[model samples]
Target: MRLDKFLKVSRIIKRRTLAKEVADQGRILINGDQAKASSNVKIGDTLTIRFGQKLVTARVNDLKETTKKEDASELYEIIKEERIEDSHLL
Candidate 1:
């Protein structure tokens, strides 16, 4: 599955376009490297998404084209979440 679509299908980002934009702007990384919206997603891959002042890390647990809302969380496991201090660049 695509990175952007996976994010949306997994209910992480909520929208595919937003996910694409985020990925394009380098706010999303896979396996510690910046990834594009078209990047392939598979099991066991770690993803880090930066949302404003927060960062969310998750490891892919499974791959699916579609899933129910109740089962969306099964797609990935949250590894860590933390706040990013000092939004203004030096």
Candidate 2:
């Protein structure tokens, strides 16, 4: 699955376009390497996403073209989450 699609299908980003935009801006990493919107994603791959002050890392647990809301959470397992303080704020 594509990174963007996987994000949406997994209910991580909420929208595919937003996922694409974030990926294009270099805010997403797969297996510790920067990834593009069209990057291929596979089961067990680790994804790190930057959302402003928060960083979330999740491991892909499953892949599906589409999933119900209740099943979305089963797609990825959150490994870690942290809030990063901006240096400019100091």
Candidate 3:
């Protein structure tokens, strides 16, 4: 699955366009390397996303074309989530 599509299908970003934009801005990483919107996402791959002040890391668990809202989280397992302190941006 494409990174942008996976993000939306998994309900991580809420929209495909937003996910694409975020990925294009170099705010997403796959396996510790920068990822593009068209990057391939496979099961067991690690993904790190930068959302404003928060950094979220998750491991892809499954891939689905579509999923129910209640089961969206089944797509990935959250490994860590941390906030970026102001000093880190300096």
Whole-model lDDT, model 1: 0.92
- Report clashes for each candidate as comma-separated counts: 0, 0, 0
Pairs in clash, predicted candidate 1 = none
Q: Among these predicted structures, which one has the highest lDDT?
A: 3
lDDT, model 1, position 8: 96
lDDT of each: 0.92, 0.92, 0.94
Ten contiguous residues minimizing lDDT sum, candidate 1: 81-90
| Residue 68 local lDDT, model 1 | 100
Summarize candidate 3's per-residue lDDT along 10-75 as a digit string, tens digits: 999999999999999899999998899999999999999988899999999999999999999999
Put down candidate 2 lDDT per residue, 27-74, tens digits, no spaces: 999999999999999999999999988889999999999999999999
lDDT of 1 at 52: 93
Taking every candidate in turn, the Cα RMSD to the unseen true structure, in Å, is 2.0, 2.7, 1.9
Candidates, ranked, lDDT: 3, 2, 1
Return the lDDT, model 2, position 86.
Answer: 74
lDDT of 1 by residue, 32-79 (tens): 888999999989999998889988999999989999999999999999
Off by over 4 Å in 1: 88-90
